[model samples]
Target: MSRKTALLLLPGLAFLLVGFLAPAVAMLLAPPGESAGTVVSRFTEMLTDPYELRIIGRTVLLALIVTVVCVALGLPIAYLLARSTSRWGGVLLAIAIFPLLLSNVVRTFGWLVVLGANGAIGRALTASGLTDDPPQLLYTPLAIVLGLTQLFLPLAVISCYSAVAQIDPGLDDAARGLGAGRARTFWTVVFPLALPGVVVAATLVFAGSVTAYTTPYLLGGSSQRMLATQLFSYASVSVDWSAAAATALIMTILVFLVSGLSSLAARKAATS
Candidate 1:
């Protein structure tokens, strides 16, 4: 309502319009010219395409798994960083975030080496009698999930740590002093306070996992296709920009619905 506030917001509004909205509009319109058939027909084709439908389903499944894995692993690391008093906590936090500083391709290649049939993990599993032979790790759903979890875990940790850090230390102290055990205090007090951050982290992880191109492409074989791979196939291989746009739009909607429902569910859980 204020002129000064409007002035301050103008740059951001301008950037959004120029950076996101314009390009998105262009892409959406690009698809309309692809076929002589109507847009409705293209939608039908996209929906009925069995391979693409499978890719969409698999992409959602993979993203959900990646989100769960990231949160499950990130919570303890975040708790440690949030509650620790030692210099090592900061050191460890930096180490946890260190992977994010590397090129995505580099990080993915690192996983490839570790998960390869001849890699250390595979050899160790075989040597330890965990398996009769080196398990087929790469080019599987397991490999993609692991790669995605590793790629996005830092975002989850940082989000959770920021949330956990915001809670009053005194609240935790009081809970413990009131005869609650450490685990009890965490569940009753700290974790509830950190729920919002957990939701944010989940959203980030899910969105990142679903939209990722390289990790899925490299770690997953032809059978383990995701939506990003499908999008790339359409755009590059088929040279169908319109179909690619449709895929992108579908992916955006999928990410939004999943994240929105997840955040809503988290809020409801927190309230009840």
Candidate 2:
């Protein structure tokens, strides 16, 4: 590279190191005034302890469920939107991602209202004679999953839309000409081409769901704690810096692992 190009990149690289990398490394290593051994021991405990294992398991399972649900729903919507020739296509695309403009807290609270004992769902159930009383739905895994799915669905849709839109519509016609059905064309052509985008969407949604604090805390409550809430308890409530650092490290590792796997899958799909 030219000296000018190297110099131009220097400032951005310096900023990235100082701004993000250094602090992230420090946090994963050990919290302030804590020994590396302390953090390591706590991390080991979290892995071995049944309580902590359950929280971690719950976090992972919920995240997987959310990712699958979002991808299953988002991919089809994105495909339809991308293939639409209607003038309303632009408007429909905008509407698909509109939830992103709303704050996460706001959307989560909307779920709170709907899932609450006296909320819409409960009221409807009672009015329909499906139940004699309002069922407790707020502080369950289901609530957390629903809230997270709503929170991340728009992101998945938009990511897949961008991916699908980049592919040539002519490819679909070409597949049809070769006597391939719509399902076969999509599986053999469109889906493979769009796999990278789907991977990106899934990675983002999984990471967000696993680390998300607001939705899980509010929806799952004290009864159904996830890793993020556990970390919060360690950091703020219990004042256990070592454990908090360990939790953060675990979350970071989980995200990185999923990202790596997703990248590998996308590359394989692209090549195949």
* Per-model CA lDDT versus the true structure: 0.87, 0.95
Off by over 4 Å in 1: 35-40, 126-133, 262-272
Reference-based lDDT, residue 218, model 1: 96
Relative to the true structure, candidate 1 reaches a TM of 0.91
**In candidate 2, what are the lDDT values of residues 71-142, reduced to their tens digit?**
999999999999999999999999999999999999999999999999999999999999999999999999
Give candidate 2's whole-model lDDT. 0.95
Give one digit per residue, the lDDT tens place, for model 1 in 1-272.
99999999999999999999987767755564664244335656888998778888899899999999999989878988889999788898999888889888999999889999899999999999999889889999999998898899999999899999998889989999999998999888988888888888998999999999999999997779898998898888988776787788788888889778877978886787
- Backbone atom clashes (below 3 Å) for every candidate: 1, 0
Top TM-score prediction, candidate number: 2
Give the winner by lDDT: 2
Local distance difference test, candidate 1: 0.87
Each prediction's TM-score versus the true structure: 0.91, 0.96
